[model samples]
Target: MQVKQVETETEQKQAYHVRNTVFVEEQKVPAELEIDELEKEAIHFVGYEDEIPVAASRLRFVDPYGKLERICVLKEYRGRSFGSQIIKAMEAAIREHGFQKSKLNAQTHAEDFYQSLGYQTVSGEFMDAGIPHVTMVKEL
Candidate 1:
């Protein structure tokens, strides 16, 4: 598997396709909500397996904090650690921008997954897009 910080339109599209498959199609997140206005301002990352995009994520610099969002791994590739790779790549990108802390609104069921990566819950459970979520943060 290979993961890189997306720097071109084609790369960005590939990332979007992965997110579309995982978030919009499979998870029932509205297409409009999945692809938000923040796309243009965020740094994107994509993970590939044998030249096929399998995971995608983005980081938005919000002042003193770097916000991680739209992280998703294709259903067929879910168990392969591509999600972790994408997150690591985004964290590196955030660090490159001089940010020392990163945050994300994680699906509640996946809270443990984020915690395993050293993120801690920073807010109580909340509803986002009709799904339960929690705010998580990690110091980089």
Candidate 2:
């Protein structure tokens, strides 16, 4: 499994498809929220397994915080560390770009996953995309 940073339009499209499958279709995330206008400025990364796109995520600046969003991996590839790899990719990008901190609104079910990645719960649970979510952050 190779974690590749997407630098071209083709890789960007592949990353979008990964997000659409994991977030829009699988998680039932609204099309409006999942499809945002921030893609143009967001830093994106795509993970490939044997030349096939399998997981992805992106980073964006929201004032003092570096927001990591659109993190998703194919269902068949979930048991592996694709999600972790994508998170690391996003973290590296944020650090390279000189960010003070990072944050992510993680689905409630995935809190443990993010926490394991050094993100701590900073706010009470809330509903996003009609699903329970919590705001978590990691000081960079």
- Candidate 1 per-residue lDDT, tens place, 104-125, comes to 9999999999999999999999
lDDT string, candidate 2, 1-140, tens digits: 67777889999999889999988888888888987888788888899999999998888899888899878899999979889988887887788889969999999999999999899999999988899999999997
lDDT of 1: 0.91
Per-candidate RMSD vs. true structure?
A: 0.9, 1.2
Which candidate achieves the best lDDT against the true structure? 1
Alpha-carbon lDDT, every model: 0.91, 0.88
User: Candidate 2: where is the Cα deviation over 4 Å?
Assistant: none
Clashes of each: 0, 0
TM-score of 1: 0.96
TM-score of each: 0.96, 0.93
| Candidate 1 deviant stretches above 4 angstroms | none
